[model samples]
Target: MHSFVYLASQSPRRSQLLEQIGIAHRLLVAQDHDPEPQDPEALEQVLPRESATDYVQRVTGLKLDAAIARLQRRGLEQAPILCSDTTVSLGRHILGKPESQEQAREMLQALSGKTHRVLTAVALQSGRKRLTSLSVSSVEFAVMDSAQIDAYVASGEPMGKAGAYGVQGRAAAYIARISGSYSGIMGLPVFETANVLRAAGFAI
Candidate 1:
């Protein structure tokens, strides 16, 4: 087992989840000086006609591939690298992070008193081997008044989150119930993540 693995994610919740399982990890984010730095943030564009599950899985794989190359470029210590991505879907329609307050409010209004699917895809890459997992959770949102949606959007927490909300944040109040992995809803499913890490020869 490696002393620690590289977690190529920007979400603090992913890091917190890994720590919960006692897996030592280091962030593997893009450096400002890279000759060919790809904007990790921009890799999340929803493809034309892509389904939610397909979108999350593809993004996660792309992220892992990028991280693997980064590890090689940085000459970092050899260890499995983990990457994951999450997306919220109302049926076939994907509700990504809102680009504006109006969009956020629209997403919130659409989700009010409705159930949505949150899909999180995770990948672990160790040299020539890779393991992957996907977690799909059902989240039911309570009906929210326009005022409530406006207030939440004003808080700015909905800007960069899937479905314009976070399960563990202020948005929790709007979540009537979740029928899947809570940790998955938070961006990393501990059970699935641990399983992949273990498969990649991590101690966890």
Candidate 2:
């Protein structure tokens, strides 16, 4: 079994989640200080008429492919590589990370007093084999007035989060309930991740 795996995500929550499961991992992220860092956002653009399930899975696959190439280019030690992507959706509308505070508020407003699906797609590359899993959870938010929405947006917790909120952050106050894996909503589904890791020949 591999001693450790490479995580290709910049989210602290994902790293923390892996640590929580007693998994040792090294970051395989593209450094911001690079002379020409790749545009990360370009990989996340929602294609026309794409479903949330398809989008998250495709992005995760793409990210894993990039990480594999990155490892080869850097001549790093080979091991399993993991990548994940999360998306929030209400009905057919997909809500990604908010670009600005105003957009964050708008996303939050749309989610107020409503339940939405939080879908997290996880992909792992072990040698020539690839494995994938998806965790779908439902989050219900309490009705929020404009003042509450404004306050949450001002705190900036919603800026970089899907559906303009974080289940593990201050937004939990207004989260009426969650119907599925909390870890999945937070970014990485623990159960799914462990299963994928085991399939990748990593001792999880």
Candidate 3:
């Protein structure tokens, strides 16, 4: 197994996923950073006109670049650095993390009784080499009532989660079906992540 890698993400779920796979990773959170979406009234504004795959890949690359620069500055550039980003997409519109409980409710309502795609992009950087992988999962949600949405919103679990829901939390009760990696839905695609890590010299 690779001795250890740097993980540039703040999501506990992502960290847990890595631990579940027995991958030794050191957390490398961005300092005083905010991931708020850029100016726009709609989620699509934050995403480029490119296809979903391309959009995710590009963002992952950018994140990897930032992380790599940080590692280099710290003289820890020898260890592999992993960066990932996840987005919940309804058609061409990307539903990112909600900024408020009201926003979370709206996102959940839109996702009610519908099938949406969850795209997770993973990037691994080691020295001058960088590799990226994408995982897309189709998720179906049952129709949720306002009461359910309100209660979930009150629980405060949707605030920092993409799509205003977490598959590993209470939101799991609302998922009707999933056609791809559950770990991917939770913010990391274990299978693809492991593949990339192994390819980058990490012992699985």
Question: Highest TM-score, which number?
Answer: 2
What is the C-alpha local distance difference test score of each model? 0.89, 0.92, 0.84
Cα lDDT over the full model 3: 0.84
Q: Is candidate 1 or candidate 3 better by TM-score?
A: 1
Ordered by TM-score, highest first, the candidates read 2, 1, 3
As a whole number from 0 to 100, the lDDT of residue 108 in candidate 3 is: 97
Error at 44, model 1, angstroms: 1.8
* Per-residue lDDT over 1-204 for candidate 3, one digit per residue giving the tens place of the 0 to 100 score: 469989988888999999999988898765656333332234223644777677677777777777776766667646888988888999877888898888999999999999999999999987677778889999999999999999999999998888999998999999999999999999889999999988988888
lDDT of 2 by residue, 63-167 (tens): 888898888878999889999999999999999999999899899899999999999999999988899999999999999999999998888899778888999
TM match of model 3 to true structure: 0.90
Show model 1 residue runs off by greater than 4 Å. 35-37
Clashing pairs in 1: none
Looking at model 1, residue 38 earns an lDDT score of: 64
Best by lDDT: 2
**Residue 122 CA error for candidate 1 (Å)?**
0.3
Determine which window of 10 residues in candidate 3 has minimal summed lDDT: 36-45
Residue 201 of model 3 has an lDDT of: 83
> Which scores higher on lDDT, 1 or 3?
1
Q: What is the full ranking by lDDT, best candidate first? A: 2, 1, 3
Better of 1 and 2 by TM-score: 2
